[model samples]
Target: MSDQATLEVRNLQTHFFTKAGVVKAVDDVSFSVGKGKILGLVGESGSGKTVTGFSILGLVDEPGRVVGGEILYRGENLVGASQERMRQLRGNNIAMIFQDPMMTLNPVLRIDTQMIEAIKAHQKVSDDEARQRCRDALGQVGIPAPEERLKSYPHQFSGGMRQRVAIAIALLNKPELIVADEPTTALDVTIQGQILYEVQKLCAETGTAMIWITHDLSVVAGLADEVAVMYAGRVVESGEVDGVLDAPQHPYTAGLIGSVPSRNARGKRLQQIPGMTPSLLNLPVGCAFKTRCSYSTPVCEAAPVLSEVAGGRQVRCHHPLATEAV
Candidate 1:
């Protein structure tokens, strides 16, 4: 990983205005990804991980907007950038891989057609040149017989293969940063592992920073260099993956790690965090995890700002769990 950060998100607040009330989809979330490094944005559904990715890409549509903060891509603020500028940057300087492969692939189009279009959209290349680039990208993602796969349609491939195609598209431009939102969630474990390895290798070779958004800690443990845990639209804890996973200081982080099946003994029942995630529109005051956290106290009633608890580690909790206990 390079010393300079490729992307820096500072106090990002993306909100949705509905008839019922305002939904704080991403509130004061902050993190950074260095060149060739991966930051896993882990959180359950509705925790704003996906929203954050969308905000960075300028993809949030009607009724929702980035209300505050800066999304600095190589020192340039993209929050106030023009639509034309964002369009130019989207598939060129930055790319996003959504959870569903169909979101990226057109059912009626051949894989080669889509991939070539993606390349030509940013660069003026000849058809043959674009096709070669497309073939090379497919090969990079471990697709078998790239030449043959390029001629196939979306439906001709399995779920995992389709995802590999989507990933290949994302890598076509060799963007400086990629925000992958659970792209491997539906794949079998073996395929997911293969994809992870390929992605990590790509980042290292190309110096492309990545934000891998998922709820799976095991994936993050193996793939991400840094981890950020989100709750109720805010980052609750963040640090180097090893330190955060082995010695989680935040109660929510601890709960998440404990709930992982491998963390339990051979025959013991898996542990679970009690209570449910609060609704964004009607979230409780202060710490959102307090209701479910065993260490909550009166001080937790007041919102806790992210504070550095140790070197390169931060947690948003009045009474953070002890590292040893975790």
Candidate 2:
């Protein structure tokens, strides 16, 4: 609600009910993103990063629901808003760029059709005005010959170009908040760099807030203003990007930083966090990460609450290492 933050998600719990059991995809996850800034949400696959984003947008479907917690946009709870209101908010006040461009682009429809529809769906505008805006959006994301490309179908564009078009649609609205789930993953490294630059420029120019979800630490280190690390569906550490990455408090966080290619110590085999992420359906009773933690002890066997550590950083580890602690 304060002027500093654009979106604040607190203790968000999203669960999926299935025949196997209840899967706590997102459990007690909390973080805040300030205006005109990028908050990187990083974790291994199936760590609930994507679901958290979907939950914030109210995109979670049947058998899966946001069971508890508050998603505050400008300090207002969006948890129980009606579908109509939510629809109005989406693509207008807020937007999302999915990992797969096909999620946003209709395969059978021409690019122009989808772009114009996205624009006019939330505003009253003539075809000419909408078309102009659509063209501009496409050009903004660096699509070549955007006017001609607009007449083409999704299948006609290369994977990277399609992703750029999808990003353009998200930027067209100049949305105040955007949740981008691995938006650059499909693009080539060169294209990915360009998109990152475009995203940063868009956020700076529009004062838009963003939560960019990715598992690549290098991506976060490059583009994000702040970083939040998630494990077992919960945030284990969060802080200013430099502070958390340079000197991580939690063992898990240190491991993540170590696993990055740049930080690979010479002659020391590349460090990696051993063991797969725990299954949400059958999460361990103790600290979910205690099983793999090098510094874990009897105290770590109990659940650790995300408490404020030094420098406004929040960490959830009972036996966090002081050597790396903020």
Candidate 3:
């Protein structure tokens, strides 16, 4: 990323100290989101994408911990930061939108109550002032009748509306970096599109960097400037969204792109990766993706470091596909 990057995760490794052994939930992950740029972290379930987001926010709970590497937020190392310091940054400078609306909302409390407390948690603003900010936030996310909605409880709103409220709270602080974990996955197509548009617009208008975590390629296609593809616990491919999606450097990435329904022939069977993702606890000796890649060679028996290819794209594969051929 450029000097204006809001977050730079370098060789991040978050592990779970299980009774069986240490599980490398996120291993050697690295990426950066520059100011106003959206970077999509795309992968299947259990690919460690969510863990990466939690590690960034210092939310990894007991039995799980950030084991190695640096999580640099605007050149400041967060790996060793104290809880108070992280709390100070959580809502003021960094905010996260969870996958579930209930994770953010209190079922019993009115929307106004939760949102006002959130604003007051980090800022010394009058309740009236904070309430107005909350009202504007709801309006920003396209919620109609903000004042009426603020009086409603969490159960009063639809799933989409609840999600919008959560997003509004995340933005209420005008954070520098927002880590959103599949924020639109639960919404309908129409609602998701509207939310995506609002999010993209907000980032551009506010110059806030974001890391959008999701398994959906289509969402990233329309919203992200850059994308990082993860397999198992590592980033297998990363580059500009168009370049990587159009001519995927890694076989796993190509597989993911091919599997997307819209990209395939209407009557043709969908393409699928050959095998299941390897268990992180007992990952293969070398390239974690080797077991599922038909293009794997003997070189793949040894772990491949994330190396740069043409056009500054990075791929963790001994045999990256030829861009011209793709």
User: 1-326 in candidate 1: lDDT tens per residue?
Assistant: 33668999999999999999999999999999998999999999999999999999999987999999999998889999999999999989999998977566788999888999899989999999999999999988888899998999999999888999998999999999999999999888998998999999999999999999999999999999999999999999999999999999998998999888873388898889999999999998988888898999899899999999889999999988787855
By TM-score, the candidates rank as 3, 1, 2
Better of 1 and 2 by TM-score: 1
By lDDT, the candidates rank as 3, 1, 2
Please give the distance, in angstroms, between residue 18's alpha carbon in candidate 3 and its true position after superposition.
0.9
**Ten-residue stretch with the least lDDT total in model 2:** 260-269
**Per-model C-alpha lDDT, please?**
0.93, 0.88, 0.93
> What TM-score does model 1 achieve against the real structure?
0.97
lDDT of 3 by residue, 231-322 (tens): 99999999999999899989999999889887438888888998898888999999999999899989988999999886758999999998
In model 3, the Cα lDDT at residue 81 comes to 99
Show the lowest summed lDDT stretch of 10 residues, model 1.
1-10
What does candidate 2's lDDT look like per residue over 1-326, in tens digits? Answer: 25758899999999999999999999999999988999999999999999999998899987999999999988778898889878888988789999976566888899999899888889999999998898998899888888899999999988888898988888777799999999988778998998999899989998999999999899999999999999989999998998888888888989988787654366777879988899999888778998888888898667889888887788888876684444
- lDDT of candidate model 1 versus the reference: 0.93
